[model samples]
Target: MSAIMKKAWGYRYWVLVILWLVYIINYFDRMAVLTFLPFIQKDLHLTPVEVGQLASVFFFAYAAAQISAGFLADKIGSKRVMYIAITVFTFVTALTGVVKNFGQFIALRIGLGLGEGHHFAPAIRAINNWFPFKERGRAVSFFATSWAVAPAIVPVIVTSISVSFFGGAWRPVFYVLAIPGAIGIFLLWRFISDSPKEMIAKGKLSKDQDIEEENVAPKKLSKEEKRKAYGVFLKDANFYVFTLCLFCQLAVYWGTSTWLTSFLVTQHGLNIKEMGFFASAPYIVAFFAMMLGGWLMDNVVHRMKPVALIGYIGSIPVLWMLGSVEKGNTGLLLTLLLLVGFFVNLNFGSIYAYLPKRYPKEIVGSATGLANGIGQLGSFISPLIAGYLVTVGANGSQDFSRVFIFFAIVSAVAALCAVILKEKKVTKVPANTIGSEKSVS
Candidate 1:
């Protein structure tokens, strides 16, 4: 191997690390609001329904933007899309501190959602660009852990800042969180490239054995061919199944994550400081769970469907237990919540690994975006439904039984969808024939 090739290989893992950092900031900005909800509620005199609407508005905008972002990433490049998204979202996150009323808060949430909505697909596309097929699951899972890590850390950080630095003021917490994201904009711009081809073209890498072997260029497709590929994706039954499975999983995920802190405070009688600390427990467990899930997918199972099936099925009982546990049984509740976290996230790496691999590189971003976009509708609706279910009674208490049942049912459906999902087998045709052909069971 030439010196350039060796250096590029050495730097490949750093790319994953950088993206991981970006994801941490991405989720930190997204989830810090949840920790601040109680303060925001008091400050703005907003009802639970309206608070739920704030989260819903973000998801609505987020879901709406995914397809366009994915298409744009594929057409232009992931690097550009990611840089623009991080910058826009960082600015929006800083502006989150400035909203004084419900309308202003909702508008800022919408803007934040629009900015962040573009992040996932492009990040996945970048993973596809960097890692080999066999290693992608582990790489993607490592990236996915930001979901757990951000929540685990952000709640503590935001809550601490709210209590200490801002005297329980939530706005300054937003401003503090936005700074790291602003810094990330420069790091990404300086370090990231769309593909190894760009590096080679720019003479950052030479045509050497190690680099050449790892950086095989993807097959090019004409515009008509690309359109046909998208049509095939739409017509395929597996696409619907996968997308629905993702939708159900996200429903369970966002439903629980969005409301768990409030539930702890209201239902379990934990104070804000206690809620912040305990709220992190589940995701703390989930951090390791997701890492284990990723490693298993890459090394042990080596298939997406069965891993997802097991995860969704396993989560049902735990979620039911979480819902049924007696109020004030904080110990049991936290345990069940942790188990639910573990099971629910087992599919994180597998889903990301599966979707991009199933489609042509030319449309991988589109397929990923479509699945995530449609799936995020679950994120949009689940919180709203939960809010409606947990209606504040005359005594100012909520009955959480119905909400728990809803999440359990959603998880059960996700497991069923996983069971029915058919993985496509791709066969390379002759070099002179069309680019590739895929057959689905």
Candidate 2:
């Protein structure tokens, strides 16, 4: 083997580290807004319903963009899609600081959603390119840690800056948060390739070395062939079940993430700083929960449905306990909320890992995109429903009891959907199948 190839082989894991960092910044930009919502609501004189509408609008645009983004990733390559998405969202997030009215705020948020929506499918494809199947659950879960880490850290960062440095102004926080994304774009552009084949072609790795032997790259397909493959996905019953399961899971997850701080502030009477601290408690537990769940999925049980079922079923009672806790019981409240976070996030990595595993590499991006896009409807609707529920309470006070119960019911539905999801054995396709216009079966 050439010296350069040996070096490249040693450096393969570094690609995962870079992707992990990008994932962190991806979520940091998204979740930072959650922490800033109270400040934004006050500054714009918006009602709780309006605040919820803003979040819902972002998810709507995000959902709408997913399928197209997936198609684009499959066509142009995940590396290119990820780079463009990172650049677009970072610019939009910085522009968020300059919006003056609700109209402009909504427009910029939609733009941010469009950009951010392209990120995940491409990231999943990239992981599939870099890691073997057996290790993918752990790798993806490690990447998924950004979900927990972002929420845990962004609250403290945004709250500290908004209160201390910006003197309660939230605009500058958005502006400053865009910086990491800018750096991420540069790193991804310089370091990332679409697949190991690209690296080998570029003389970065040896042709003889079988770094990814277990997960061979799929042959490129013609446009007609691509359409036929997607048609097969449309006809698959398991696809709908998996997508529906994700929809239910995300509905409960996004609803809680979007409104948890607001719930604490208005319902529990906690101040912004106190709210930030308390809100972070659950995600801290979630970080460990996600890691443990991923480890178990990769090492012990290979099926995602059972793990996801546990997360959803276990979350129901914890969510109820969260809703029932009295205002002054800080310790008990935090404990219940922590469990809620743990259970809700337990399947984060496994679900994404499961998607690509079920589909051939040629259509994995499409499958991921379609599932995530349809799943985002849950995120798009749940916050809006919760807002309406909270808004209808007496004398402008929000009744979170009803909202919590609603999420519990949603969790139950998600758990049931999980029970219905069956794992499919992936079949190998012949090289001759790549150019054929016939539907994949």
Candidate 3:
């Protein structure tokens, strides 16, 4: 390869590209279960409540593991942590096909969650390490789009496999989707470097070039320093507010995404194919909104603490309308879902930008893990609640109306919380390890 091309695909860009691809596979494997849920429900003779419990298995494991994963990422290298995580989940997800009963199915899903739990906590840490302060928002926002895109494409792909290639066997769909994930493991193993120091050494690049390449100052922390870093973050009220806001956001976000497909089929008379297309539309809107939100949030950070509060508050009406719209008016329902998905996702970018902007780099990963971990609990609860509501109202009546209202109220509360978050100036960034370079008053 020419030097120009080699420089273009240098270690920095290569790491980012491969990690992004890994994230895409991460989301695809995790969300494959949702699209397959209706079939799983029928085949397993499970009730709606039982299905909700099964789905909750993923979140239970995910939420429970975040802190430990964050701690591990801080101790071990994030790349090694991620590699182990991806391998664990990929194997378990493939094995999900072989389960013969609900008990075994739930067990496998829980294991899937445990394996996948290590991803966002450490991946966010990796991004925070690699990207500069100004560019981190866009970097995080772009990766966050995996949540949007995987659901959009994976459903169609998995549905096709489930229907035709597998002779309508959901088990075969699980097995097939696991193939690409295994390939991702090999890619990560070959290309992923743990830190900029390692990347520079392995690639035979100058230390100065590596620092300039990633726009990061080389900072190494000891165990005590890492502990104190997290300690500082834990004592900050701003972190608490961000965590609470994220928790509420998760409730509404997952509540809608998890159930929207089934809602279309049961209440709006959408067939499986139609439901797949429509379900993907909102996340498509969300993809653009997240990108836009990240850009706008950074531009206006000094002036507006609640940069995406409008989007969050605005979603209440949109979500309420989503569940209240007429069954025959698919256009109107689609509009509501699309807007809700857009604004709800916009909050994701805004919150990520907001947090790191206000906090120092030393504890960015730990704070983010705590917030995102707490948020995962909301993810755990929302779908299970929706499932119970649907099960009890299963006499063909749309009971999800009240559920939608609940999320609207929860989102409104999130907006209010967003307003109260005090944005502090991140005064100093230490060069190597954590110490009192400059003090914050």
Candidate 4:
């Protein structure tokens, strides 16, 4: 094996493993609320619209916080920012149990969003620092697997916890979940260093140490110049197009996943437990699809380019078919939903892999944060909109048919936008250009 490959399979592999676990917890905490939504709704005596709004408040804060977090991650180091963010998130997640009213609930959800929002931009930056460009797709995808794993495992855990410890009460479920996060914070403090300089100096040096230090050493940029550069990134056509693509994708995926369990229970007449099992089926399929997709994107396709478009366009018809399925067709519904999960998550690693390839390292976190912030707004809005549609249906009916059709249309639009995404061959970072930490500046 090559030297890098040999190293990758050793201690560096452990680094990747740790990063993935951190992300798993990150996603677990973020999504644990969703799995418990039904219980929360019932306990609070909330209507469908209120439930949706509560769910959305987290995303609203998450989306807004990502922008500033991106900039802050660069100003400080990703490691420190992540350490603080994770601790804050864990505490807030635990505190969610204590909420007595809608206002308190809303405040806690917003805090959850803001705390969790910092994880992605910084995590991606750390991945770029740890792995070389050639291996990034697979490396990053390995981390991105948290999305699939979260839905697959977290719901099951939350269900068990609710049944066993919380006596089916959603409030104490949050408290129990927060205990491990305390340990997670300590591990982050002990192991994760911002860059290789810290890594090597801390006696953890390995190969490529020089390259990592070169990447992290501070540079200087004037305030006015930083503003001009941020302006350039914001005004770029390709950036906006990519943002819209993610927006559509998140809208469709979140809309479907957020409501899938409820849909199965209400429309198909399945019990809550059955709905949980059905909801988990897609994430199971997604796990294999993501692993295989990452391998294919890296080992075979190697274009590292437009393969994301294929994943997007291919999902349109699948989602359409999923929407068109009749309520009684359990076999067909499960099959198609599985495929939807696979294809939707298939492109996830590819989309994130595109950012570090296209942007200069200096601004990659900001650019990623910008894209994620814009895309995550869809996460904020999709649930709210879907709930409104269902609530406003004839005679308080919760028919998700129209919502499904809208999601299908959005998927197609995303495919069209993905087709227009520019693929730059190289990133040009001018030598000796010093600027402020551009986390948000």
Candidate 5:
């Protein structure tokens, strides 16, 4: 590669790229179930509520695991925690292909959740370790694209395999899905380190690079110090506000995403192929929308709240329209879903940009983990609640319109919480981490 090319794809960006790919696999495992939900529901003879439970249980387990994952990443190092998470979840994903009953299905979902839950906080911590506050908007925003792209691709990829290779078997797609996780495992082990310093030591990163945490080695915190870190964020009102905001955001994201297939296939009368195309459309738009949102956060607003507030407020009408669109109005459905994808996803760039800036680098993982964990409570509730909201028409077909209305209301709650978050600096980022970073959360 040319020097300019190498500089553009340098270790800093490569780290982000690796984490992004891993997260893509993570969503693939999570959302593949949703994509295959109608198939799974039929094959297993499952109720809509039961299908919701399968998705909900994963978040419950995922939410429960986040705090501990953060602490362990802080304590042991992100590399190891990530290694373990990847191993457990990939194994669980493959096991999913073999599930013959509901009990086994739920078990795999929880296992997937528990294993996947640990990956995010640690990956965020690793990014915080490398990028300074200024570059983080782009770095984290790009990483967040995995969330958008993976979901956009999942419906198509899984549907194609189910139809073409396996003759519509949902089970075999899990086996295919597990391949990326295996590749991610090798990538994580081979190239990634917990911090830039470790990468430098391994000679993967060139010496004398202008990177944060380039000289500071990873530290293992004592029990007393860990407690003190937790206490620091605990006292910050922004912590509570951010967590609540995440809860609301998760409701909008997971609640809608978890049930998207059913909403398209069941309510709108789209076939699996049509559902795949329509479902992929929103997330495809989200990739560009979120990228623009992140760029705006860095150069335009120079803060997260204004940008995010706009997103939260903007999503309300779109989500409501998404639900209210009558069956067979394919044109309106496409337009509304596209708008939801754009407005709803715009929150992430600013949302993720705040964490590493707001908390001490030593405890960024814990802060992120705890906030995300608490936020996932919203993730846990929305799907199951949406499941319950499924109305049976006189024709006995299920309608999921009420679920989008629920998300619309929850988006308003998120907007209110976003209002509570402060823009002023809250915690001092250690000089080694960011050369005097201000609180951005």
Candidate 6:
């Protein structure tokens, strides 16, 4: 098994593949609602505010679950936490097909958020566990592409499925989407371990590198241990700034993603089918944006702030210009969407690359969880505020100008936060250096 595994692909690459696929499933299920927002809104007689509530509520639940989930990942093992997450979220997704009212939809959306929120920090923990310093940047960056990929293709795939197979019903699309998630569960069990030491001890892999891993078993933590873990990151002043920056970035991200489809349809006057392809245009550029951001962080900048700052600053003008676009100008609209996609997405790889370098790997899950969890507050409010700003006229048209302005404001905030961040320097150790700090910058 080991020889065949090594011959086909290294175990680390296999882990990346499995995690990436699972993340794609995670996002596909999450994005299905947004892709068909107009249908869901129409069917439920939902107002603009309520349409925004569905998206914001999910982030609220997702954010609320993150800290506990991060702590759980540190305690129980990333793989175990992931197993629970995949099962719960997938089940919740299937149940979404049958909701009959706003209350039921909110209940199930909360379920989906709680289930999926646990997966991310654990996945970050796993990447740090498996990859060495130099290569970790590229590894995490590639894994992050699942975000762009799932949303990029989901609009086309889900839209086509709804229009063709289910006769344009949104609910059935959720049911079809749920089936593929089980594959992620099975893959995680077959191929993943919590750490390299565990993999080596189990005879699934050989000790191929100079990594000296701690043989920490997943077990119940003492109250003091938990406190110390939480306290360590809590005391770090930089963590607050980092979290704030993440907050702004996610605010822009979720706000744009959650509302972009509706904006294209209602304001720009595109049919749903045309909206799907146009909706996907920005994210296609985003896939390359993340890749290039990762490459630049690893090879060129060697610092995360510059990359993040550039992304935030570069996106501001693009976002502001989106308000100037007139309906039926698909050419200019596509150009602006593509630009906004590139700029907002460019910093994720750089931000992700910064985490393992900034904190001890032992506490990375907690650090990441808290930061991202707080960041989700931004995620929650952006959509809700956008929904509030979305003025629906008596004639059934939407004015989305304020939403674009809001995104630009947040992008500016993120750039300012990036400017205040201090660069970190990792001490280079010999290949045999183990159990201390890993390379980040």
Which 10-residue window of candidate 1 scores lowest in summed lDDT?
426-435
In candidate 2, what are the lDDT values of residues 1-441, reduced to their tens digit? 445534444555677888888988888788777767767788878886677678789999999889888888888989889988888899988887887778888898899899999998898888887777777788888888888888788777777888998888889998998889988988797777777778777876555465756444567887677767776567777789888888988899889987897789888889867887788888898888888778878888877877898899999998877876888899998888888978999988888787776777788888889899999999999987876666434666665887888899999988888888777745543444422222222
Give me the overall lDDT of model 6: 0.81
Clashes of each: 0, 0, 0, 6, 0, 0
Q: Write the per-residue lDDT of candidate 3 for residues 149-266, one digit (tens) a residue.
A: 7777887778777788778788887787778888888987776666565665677433543354444523667666666666566777767887778888888888888888778887
Model 2 has a clash total of 0
Query: Candidate 3, which segments miss by more than 4 Å at Cα?
Result: 1-11, 204-218, 300-304, 387-395, 425-441
lDDT of each: 0.80, 0.81, 0.74, 0.74, 0.82, 0.81
Where is the poorest 10-residue window by lDDT in model 4? 432-441
Model 6 agreement with the true structure over 1-441: per-residue lDDT tens digits: 656454212667788888999999999888887777778888889986677678778999999888878878887889999999999999999998888889998999999999999899899888877776566667788888899999888777888898899888888898898778888888898889997677778877776545544323333446665565455568766679889999999999888987887799889989967987888888898889988888887788777888898899999999988966999888999999999989999988778767776665657788888888998899998887877788889998898988899899999999998999875633322233322334334
Task: Say which prediction, candidate 1 or candidate 6, comes out ahead on TM-score.
Answer: 1
The 10 consecutive residues of candidate 6 with the worst lDDT sum are: 427-436
Per-residue lDDT for 147-222 in model 5, tens only? 9998777777788888999998889888887789889999998768887677667766565545445225546556
User: 441 in model 2: Cα distance from truth in Å?
Assistant: 21
- Give per-residue lDDT, candidate 2, residue 372: 93
| Model 4 agreement with the true structure over 261-375: per-residue lDDT tens digits | 7778777778777777788888888777777666777778764335666677778778767755777898998888888888888877777877766666556778888889989
Against the hidden reference, what TM-scores do the models get?
0.92, 0.91, 0.90, 0.89, 0.91, 0.90
- The window of 10 residues in a row where model 3 has the poorest summed lDDT is 432-441
The TM-score of candidate 4 is: 0.89
Error of 4 at 190 (Å): 2.2
Model 6 TM-score is 0.90
Residues 1-441, candidate 1: write the lDDT tens digits.
346433555556777889999988888888787767777889899996788678789999999888888888888788899888998899888888887899999988988888899998999988888777667788888899988888788777777778998788888888887789877887787777777777667766554444534344456667766666676577777889999999998999989988787788787788867887777788888877777777887788777877898788888888877766787788898788878888988888778888765765666788888889999999988988887787577998866777888898999999889889877643332234333555532
Clashing pairs in 2: none
Per-residue error (Å), model 4, residue 275: 1.3
